[model samples]
Target: MLLGFQDRLFGLTGSGISVESGLATFRGAEGLWNGYRLEDVATPEAWDADPELVWRFYSMRRRETMAVQPNAAHRTLAAFEKRLGDRFYLCTQNVDDLHERAGSQRLHHMHGTLFQSRCVLCGRTFADSGLYERPDSMPKCSNCGGVVRPQIV
Candidate 1:
């Protein structure tokens, strides 16, 4: 089915677009991360109860995401977008910024973005510029002075 897509001028993509870019799919038997369950750390309740642990997990993921570059598939889609302009649309479930780094101007993040943080109190979202080694340091919301957490989904 993918081979047939090459001739088409416009198309949509999913998680598959990022798999080749070194992002792991959070399914299957081997999908577990460090023996921790996804539900335990990837929920609003988890953040409310233990924000530090949740921040640790997301911070490590952000570090890994920062290490990888966009692969051929991402670059191809970017080139396609350049050729098709507004006719092409891209929707990605992966949170890494590879698609954006690959020059994809027309795209949407269905799940969320890894490089963004949100305030737990007021629910305000913003870009995270700090590195992962500083996980112990909590980000304060410029709007409400509340601690901010990464908005991972």
Candidate 2:
């Protein structure tokens, strides 16, 4: 369709795309819901009520994400981006780093990223791949000294 009329492509990826990489989908057999509920660790109120607990939940997820690699689906999308250049747009609901690891430069993480943290007050975001070595240690925004939360939806 590049020369026909519409000369662009849009690709949307979700948790399923990362499942083949041995990662759990949101509602799959090995999903996060197996042990946790949204109200307990995936909601803003949950974070507000117990930041530590929320952090703990995400920390486990970070560990799991780190252990896996990008699967073929991720690589295919990256290849499409490479071939199409600006003509292709990719938006993903997954918060993992698989797509980026697969070399997809032009991507939009609509659900936020797992390895990133943003300041709730200052709204500044930066890469944070640490597993927070110390207990009771939470990231703080350097600008306004606000609490940093996971960049996930």
Candidate 3:
């Protein structure tokens, strides 16, 4: 309770919240991820082994994330944050933008974000909503002339 824990820190830990917004879980019964394994697309080693494949995987994820809107639970969390202000905090494992779209300001993406990317060579990150379906179409980092990768943790 807020009153009971007024002198202590209160926070919320949320995992798998993105699934309620129609996004698939990483280890769910999905054909693509389960068939390929998470290491092939979610790790820095995987990106080094095959950057193109990684791009393709994240591109698909970005498209799917872009298609869905925040669910009622996400909206409720956002509303709750507005009410609780600094007393409430949200940490999520989901990479989707559902929480942000729902208007949550006191939230932290524990995994990373699907709508943003970073440069492996320069460490510059930017908002990227465009689908890079083709490997050749993947944006190049303007700062270092290196391949830009998804900014997910």
Residues 80-129 of candidate 1 have per-residue lDDT tens digits of: 88876776788877788888999998888888888999887899999895
Give per-residue lDDT, candidate 3, residue 76.
80
Candidate 2 lDDT over 53-111, as tens digits, reads 78877887899999999998899888888888888889999999999999998999999
Q: What's the residue-level lDDT of 59 in candidate 2? A: 82
Angstrom error of the Cα, residue 47, model 3: value is: 0.2
Q: What is the C-alpha lDDT of each candidate?
A: 0.77, 0.85, 0.79
TM-score of each: 0.83, 0.88, 0.86
Global local distance difference test of model 2? 0.85
4: Cα error in model 1, Å: 15
Worst 10 residues of 1 by lDDT: 1-10
Q: Which pairs clash (backbone N, Cα, C closer than 3 Å) in model 2?
A: none
Off by over 4 Å in 1: 1-11, 131-135
Against the true structure, whose lDDT is highest?
A: 2
Top candidate, metric TM-score: 2
Question: Which pairs clash in model 1?
Answer: none
